[model samples]
Target: MESKTVLYIILASIVALGIVVFQYIYKQKAKSKIYLLLAFLRFIGIFGLLLLLINPQFAQKTYTLEKPNLVILADNSTSVAENGKELNNIISKIKATKELSNRFKITDYKFGSDLNILDSLTFKGKNTNIHNSLSALKDVYAREQMVTLILSDGNQTIGEDYSYFKAERNNTIYSMVLGDTTKYKDISVGPIQTNKYAFLKNKFPLETYVSYQGNTPVSVFVSVKMNGKIVHRENLKLNSDVNFKAISIQVDANSVGIKNLEVKVSPLAEERNIKNNRRSTSIEVIDEKTKIALVSDILHPDLGALKKAIESNEQREVSIFKSSASKNVLEDVDLFIFYQPTAKFKQSFDFAKSKNANTFIITGSQTDYTFINNSNIGIEIENGYPQQEIFGLLNNAFTKYDTASFDLTDFPPLISDAGPILITSPFETLLGTQIKGLNVQQPLLSVIDENSSKRALLLGENLWKWRVQTYRNTNEFINFDEFIGNLIRYLTSSKNKSRLNVDYEKVYQGSSNAVITATYFDEAFLFDQNAKIRIQVTNKEAQKSQTSPMVLKNGYFEADLTNLVAGEYEFIVSVEKESKTAKGTFVISEFDMENQFVSSDNLKMEKLAVNSGGKVFYPSQIEDLINDLSTNKAYVPTEKGTENIVSLIDFKKLLAIIIIAFTAEWFIRKYNGLI
Candidate 1:
């Protein structure tokens, strides 16, 4: 309380005493025992009422003992369930230990595909993500002095490696292995890499690793099969020192549609697990091809580079033609590459507009800006004197398609006419211009879609230099070629030109849920938030079908196919009140990630323990772990104190006392006929 409040309280008491003396002694002039009692009552009532008006406050201090957090994370994946009996014993002992229960607050969780409070364990999770679980706990107990205990087989099938995870300085992590440690003779095939889309009549490459675990020299045959027929085969010899072999083979995409392929390795005679000896994957064989017409007024090396890059994919063909001959080839072309277009190319642009075909416009010194602007191509450039060399800076916000595969940081600059460019149409800039180490916020490559026609604008020439630089850095042309191919694919793709666009993957792992997303647009091309979307899924093998509504989330309509069984599925996404619909197919492989391991990864568990300032123990040594935690000096309880100010007027007991005093005084007066 402040000095002013103390002064007010003292004055209130003195005033109360004076008022009581004046009433009982001065005014009444009576000397009796009753008079003394009346004076005391009056003094208390006046003081209490004055004190309420003053509202004096008092300080209070409170102390509490905050217990440290003890988090127990257990593996609920099927791979660790083999040692469930031992795991249960360890958990029971920890729970029954009074030392730990009194020393810290205990929280139990079981994790596999997700983390959940410990109620019971079914051990049916298809995947294990140890890193994700640990990351979540780090955030939840960031401020608490926490000690984490994990029980798992260390067979992480998904997410990044947990051995590299960094724990908080105030927190410690201990791991307990919970599977067989004995190594057995095993041969497995895994980690198959292949493209999801293949061109018909073309051969696609598939790479896989065959691993063996045994001391004896063994010979096995790795084979690729399609529709129960062997397409390719190879023989491999392995010993204890050389137990791993990488097998790469190309299989013909003979037919169209979805093709399911299986890769198998001959298992050892005494192999304990054969579930991992074979892997299945799916690839879609597309028969549709795109034809591109590249028309230019002058011959340049960029023309050759663009043609080579765009034609790298077997599904696309690029034909070069002079500006005068562009009109004859525009009839059958799906896309037009207008390179440094001049007045002579006016008819080609008009033809492309009439056919509603997509075009990739490349501008340079020879570009006729007046003709281009008059052609109504949604862009206008004011040509200036000297040419500017601008480097490409990738735009991270570009959403039309993915450009993650391109590394534009060290690319060579392109030559363009020095000018101030203006684009009236709304466009997604794929690459912005950077001149002399400064970002100019100008578009180097942009895409626009209007009137159902898609067009891409490149504000410079000499793209061949970028391709050459990419090849020099990466020692391959695939990266640069794929980058150009993606742009061409985007321009020629018919799906983006539609009002309803759907996106999904062609292949998914059975351990994870498959998701299909869609976007609906109004007549003005704005996102329609009120649109309702639905999907109908049919299993190709099982011949069963189901329909479900897609929920709107974060501006996209999504459907989760978590309940679908592992097989090939075909789905159709449609809008409820509109005729817009999209059809696609996907395959879910029945590959259980958790079941791929035959023994616990003890090395990883040990590394994780050492990195987190803890120890690794097995189920039998859990008692020692408990004792260590109990004696650890860093995991002690902390003393927490809090101070609060409480007002005296807020007390109900004070009010009760005032009421009682007044009542007593009234009764005395009434009994003495002084009412």
Candidate 2:
């Protein structure tokens, strides 16, 4: 196709012609028509071979008239069909407009918690997530001219806000607002906020957000009911409509185990929506005391701060001692926190190591790396250099526990020896060191999970600086105290001694989805998904039992127990192959989320329509909506062209032609008495 290829083909043809002339005209005695035919066949075969060598290709063009995509995203959640009559009217209107498919490509989808292509709507979805629906549509029809029609009540129960979506300039979104938008007298109790665990004899706080929708001032009575009895009560004066008040209540933890606390605001006489006036949450009250012994080389402020932080939790008791005195205390405590252990503390360290106690070591200038390396700890500090100040940066992938409070953006740096921190065994690093504003690939805080013992390492000292700096910034020690407490809790907690581990909460709200996850480990302590984990659940109140198998996903087994009725429940998780069993109890407290709101969010739907250059319409205005969409200039169909490049050598017919030409020439040569 190019000039260079043409020139090469011409040169090849000339060479073939000279060869044919030499073979037939000069060498052959007979110069008749047969000889000429033979020379011509030879030249033809040579030129055909040269052409095949060129490997020419051509473009195959295709033309098409692509219609604009009309995406109808229908909300199939329960909120959309709260009133069956209104939902039916909307569906009937959508079906009546099916004739629009004649000019546009119609694509129907249904969205609740997940987005899916719709065969039909059943309106059985439990949660509504409008954001996921539109985002999924945007990803699927990214390059197509699309006009989306969203029909919903616009009550999103989960995921991010849908108003933040940036729709394409050419694309349009028309929303059909559903349900009643008129204001209704209502009182609702929002989510409960409280600590997950409480100590016996200590009082824990419960905070709830109470909202009201009424014009007149009302005296709302907030009460905490435990075990079906009122434990605490208070009254608040709500002055205006659309106002929210935060109420805090404290309850004494008189006994251990899981305690279900119900917080409710007594509804007004005229309030019609009373289903959301109450909320329930549970907390575990434990009596076990985790005794920790702090072993230090010398008396320092860092040591004292660490002791205070660990002891802040009522369940934890920290005893500080010099390295010489630590050996005597190591036998009495469950965990050892060694601060800057030097040669003098070698005997105490060996005693703790021999006892197989959970240990957390903090390294500093006085830390003897040689002595630490000789120990069976999972990490070894190599090429030790001068001490340096390094800030802490959270490792995002750490899955040991909730790391949301590990944010250290404004926190000061800690002092540690500068060098590569080497990890020798299987471990997880929670924090990495950052030097001079650049993240370095060195673990600042890490956990080592060994079969025999659980160990943790903090590759720095001067932890007192964090407490001081945090207090200076926020006028509180919440960050540093929580961080240190969480670290100690993680280090001191018992290791996964069992091959099968079930992770779940003690209780869950009835209206919310309940999920329990389990991990199965083989004899080698490796995650084994094929171990076959199954759970036997029993309603403790009714004595009804059922068994279900957990599905394996991403090296973990997950069981969804969301549809269970409100009652006290117990579950026994068993691994079929391992013959290991774990039992746990949880209560599903009654709470109806569907009845929280009685009206649709028409404002959200209006904003979605306006932002996408479209109009919002009610179910009765469907015909007008259809007319507007059909007349829009940008929504019309457009011609599209597609081109494909195909190589000539790839065609089987061309190969057959080449074979036939070579065969026929050979036959003609043989018949003409030419070899």
How high is each candidate's TM-score?
0.67, 0.67
On a 0 to 100 scale, what is the lDDT of residue 544 in model 1? 91
**Model 1 lDDT per residue over 1-675, tens place:** 778899999999999999999999999999999989989998999899898889998788899999999999989888877787777778888988999999989989999978889898778777899999999999999998898999999999889999999999978999998888789988999778999898898999999899989899999999998867899898999989999999888889999988778899988888888988999888889887788999987999999999999888878888988877845556788999999998988787788888888999999988888888888777988875588889989988999989987887578889998477788987889999999999988889999977668899999989999889888998989888998998998888864357899899998867266899999999998999899899999998888999999999998899999777789999999998799999998998777777778789999999998998999999878779999999988888989999899885755877888889989999999999876
Question: Each candidate: what lDDT?
Answer: 0.88, 0.81
TM-score, model 1 to reference: 0.67
Model 2 Cα lDDT, one tens digit per residue, 559-644: 99987888788999998856699999887877655557868898989899889888899888878887887776777778778988
Error of 2 at 178 (Å): 0.7
Separate clash counts for every candidate? 0, 0
Q: Candidate 2 — which residues are off by over 4 angstroms?
A: 1-47, 50-59, 88-92, 95-99, 289-496, 645-659, 671-675
Stretches of candidate 1 above 4 Å error? 1-12, 19-46, 49-67, 96-104, 291-450, 454-496, 511-513, 622-644, 651-675
